[model samples]
Target chain A: MKIKTDKIKKISKSSFTIYGMVIMAYVIMQILVSTGSLSSLMEGLLVPLCIYVILAVSLNLTVGILGELSLGHAGFMCVGAFTGAFFSVATVDLITIPLLRFGIAIILGALAAAVFGIILGIPVLRLRGDYLAIVTLAFGEIIKNFVNVIYIGTDKNGFHFSMKDAVALKLEEGGKVIINGAQGITGTPNDSTFTIGIILIIIILFVILNLVNSRAGRAIMAIRDNRIAAESIGINITKYKLMAFTISASMAGVAGVLYAHNLSTLTALPKNFGYNMSIMILVFVVLGGIGNVGGSIIAAVLLTLLPELLRGLNDYRMLIYAIVLIVMMIFNSSPKAIELREKYSLKRLFTKKTKGEDA
Target chain B: MALLDVKNLGISFGGLRAVDSFHIEVEKGQLYGLIGPNGAGKTTVFNMLTGVYQPGDGKITLDGNDITGKRTIDINRAGIARTFQNIRLFKELTVMDNVKVGLHEHYKYSTIAGILRLPSYYKKEKEMNEKALELLKVFDLDKEKDFLASNLPYGKQRKLEIARALATNPKLLLLDEPAAGMNPNETKELMDTIRFVRDEFDMTILLIEHDMKLVAGICEKLTVLNFGQVLAEGNTAEVLKNPQVITAYLGE
Candidate 1:
């Protein structure tokens, strides 16, 4: 019984460390914002920061944990964003309570993205390495283009969806066009709060951290480390891969929901949910340390806020950001850094000293 | 009846018969060895049995059930687990995590339970860790439980692989070159460990090895393959003494 508790304690210790850091950062920021110490620009960046953190963490589950290269994460996010925004708009009159409406929209959005995950994962997961990455990249572009031309409106009869022209959908009296082709969804309720975003991040961390330490997570990691050995040990590779991918997509969908609600109008522009967005999320996972969930959160928050914080640099903001990214990549992956990390790890710091000790 | 029966198992890669007309019948609790020179297609036979490769010619029966051409994971769940010729431990994971991966199918909690950290999740996770620790202790690897699998010494890594294979609770275990890169003393220890595993677990084991001394020390029965076909089969000493086996080991 003691051993059992000890085992559980070990798992929770790592989780608490990460969760603690995130909570501390959250509290400090909240205090700063409330005390009027933080600038308005920094205050406005909070929701975007949370959304990127969620994306980085979710993408890490695939790229870092599962050891698969996925470049369609923003595609899943777009699915969630459009679906969530559409739901909020269509039900704006029926759902008087903003929180309840936002809640249902997020859930529906996550379900829609998960469905897309399954649809894409069935064929895409079969490809390995660069092929998989390319296919997913293509998938993101496809989704962005598809949503750009989509038109949806609601009236007394019901919802009308048209692919080509918004004018083709002749509606009844008092009908409101929710989604105008190329113009995006208008009048989405801005129900997302800093508190709600924090709550969602906590939820995402809970789900992802628990999954990473679970039995299924082990199977998925085994598949990543060695597929043949995993299969020979009775791990169903396809099943576990699909499970991780779908859950990752759903989490990104949650981020999408947050993003949709935080804005009065949500667009599927190339600049918003495009290939670059996917690559940016991947950069967060890579720079944060792959498979390191806590690292991802820190990286996401810092990277998201870096540009705004560097407003004085103006033209050099992006240049500095690029240099910082390159330097971080080198420091994170170089052999010397790895050795240093091994020597000075938190585990070693807290534990007893053994032989081969060098300062 | 035989616990595992394979008859006329054959596979060809690009018209080259990697393994052909292979046949073996292993009874429960038997320690069987398959020996051959380099490129004798010994590993191919193991692959075929574990469903890594579909045998084009024959049927495999595991205790009266036909499992030919089934998926690899299904074959394992049907009571066969394997180690690799090249150690394939989850290198980045801790030794305990490497073993816990083998206990995957044993956990009964739902995905939702795992995500939510419900009581059942904690219960099963604890059980798995405890069980994994016990297996590590058997191989004397409990002290290194937290060490990364890739950081272990080569011999310990080999032992960890066997320990992990055993964690699957398999009725039939396939070990491919478990003693590769080991000194003679380590190989002897591995022989004793194999013997202990068989007697203690009461499980059948099929091993592919080139180490004649280790094979003679532990294996009761032996089969020699050459050019993807069986060269001889009998008692380990008798098969080792066969001219065909000797010639296969040496040049023409």
Candidate 2:
């Protein structure tokens, strides 16, 4: 019984550490902005940092927890961005308030992405590791390109859709083209603030960490460790797998909504919502150490910030990024590095302090 | 009526007759053993019983309910739980969490309840934690409850597997080679544990074992199979004394 409490306490403490880290960073960034120390370029990146953090954490759920590599997360984000942007654009006049409208848009975006996740997971999850990864990669690219051909317009006839150019919709006067195919949706309200992004990160952390410690989480992890044993123990393999996948995709969708609301224009480009974006999120998960949520959070922040910080070194920007990735890989995973890290970890210091109190 | 009854149970891997017309009956609280030489298809029978493999022929009834060829999860829910010969513990999960996973169906809470952490989540989780601890205690593993299953020594891993199996609250427990890798001391302790589990849980057990002493000591009844056919089925001592069984074990 005492051991159980210690375990629970340990879980909560680690979670608090993560929360503390985020809040501390927020305060420091705010201080920098107020003192005019941070550049205008760095300030622009505040919201994007939140989006990448979210993407990395959600992808960790699929790759680390569910033990399935999903490279099409960007596709779900693409779906969310377009759908949320469309909702906001279409209903701009109907809903005058930004908060209520963006809230509903986030929900709409998340639901759309979850639907796609279910559709993809139902078939693709049947395949194991490499095949699933390849299929998801293809799906990510397909979603990006698929959005490029779509055209939607709002008129008296109530939303015209066309696979061709925006002109094919043949809109009447005063009708608005909300989605201009590859040009994408523009005039989306910039509802995202750094504060809101931080709050969302807290919520995601709560949902994910809570889920991981619960009975459902244990069942999911069991399936990951040994599928046959989990089945024999009566865990519904498909249900848990689909649950984790859909939840992850939904979180990615929320991140997408956040991203769309932060931008004046939302586009499903190869660089933004394509396979490259998917791989970037995956690198955050992998380099952060799979299943280590806090590590991924830090990885997302550092990796996102590094490119900007190294912007002064134009010729060697990506080179520095690559070197950092390799170094982080070694530092996070190598046995000797782990030993050194633990030997000097803040956790150890805290433990010693507590032990002294106990003494 | 038997706790578990199988008649003419068979499965074929394409053209190969893996287990041909197998038969066994385990009464309530009986310690039944299935023994055979390597390649005698012992594990195949276990697979069929646990719904890992659909039987090519015959019926499987547990507590008089037909559970033939159900999915593995369904069969477990229907009161049959099993452990693997190779010790398929959830290696990454803590010992307590591993057992808690087996108690999954018995504990009632939705994914939403878990995520939002409603009052019921605390209530159920506390109860599960206590119950899982009680199970680990039964295996003398309560101390290592927080350790990952992979970090456990070999013998404890085997015991943890059984503890996980029993956590399902199954009426019958199937152990595939529970003593496969145990030393003599560990094997003796395991024998005591199997007997204690049978008595304490009122469990009907069917185990596959290569350890002759373990089989002869704990098993009240024995079924010997050779080349997918049941060579003999009777009292443990009588089966061990049979010349054909000896021949099957040692060969001419």
**In terms of DockQ, which candidate is strongest?**
1
Predictions' DockQ, in order: 0.57, 0.53
State the weakest 10-residue window (summed lDDT) of model 1 chain A: A348-357
Q: By DockQ thresholds, what CAPRI class is model 1?
A: medium
Candidate 2 ranges with C-alpha deviation above 4 Å = A1-4, A312-335, A338-359
Across B1-252, the per-residue lDDT of candidate 1 in tens digits comes to: 999999999999997999889999898999999999899999999989999898888999998889999989899889888999999999877788899988888867988898887888878878888899889998999988877787788989999999998988998999999889999989988998889899888989999998878888899899899999998998888888888788889866
lDDT of 2 by residue, A1-359 (tens): 23345667767788788889889999999999899999899999999999999999999999989999888899989988888999999999999999999999999999999999999888877665676688788989999999899999999888999999999999999999999998999999999999888988999989999999898999999999999999999999989999999999999999999999999998889989987789889989987878889988988998888877777775675576578678877787898986666556545311211211111
lDDT of 1 at A88: 92
lDDT of 2 by residue, B1-252 (tens): 988999999988889998998999999999999999999999999999999899999999999899998999999999999999899999878888899999999998998999988888888888888898999999999988777787788999999999999999999999999999789999999999999999999999999999999999999999999999999999999999999999999987
lDDT (C-alpha, whole model) for all candidates: 0.86, 0.89
> Where in model 1 is the C-alpha error above 4 Å?
A1-7, A312-322, A347-359
Judged by lDDT, which candidate is best?
2
The stretch of ten residues in a row with the least summed lDDT in candidate 2 chain B is: B143-152
What TM-scores do the predictions have? 0.96, 0.95
lDDT of 1 by residue, A1-359 (tens): 23344445666777888788778988999999889999788888888999999999999999888888999899999999999999998888899999999999989989999999888888877665566688779989999999888888888898888987878778788888888988899899999988888889899999998888788887888889887788788887788898999999999999999999999988898777998799889888987888888878888887777777766776675577578789987897899987777667756311222224332
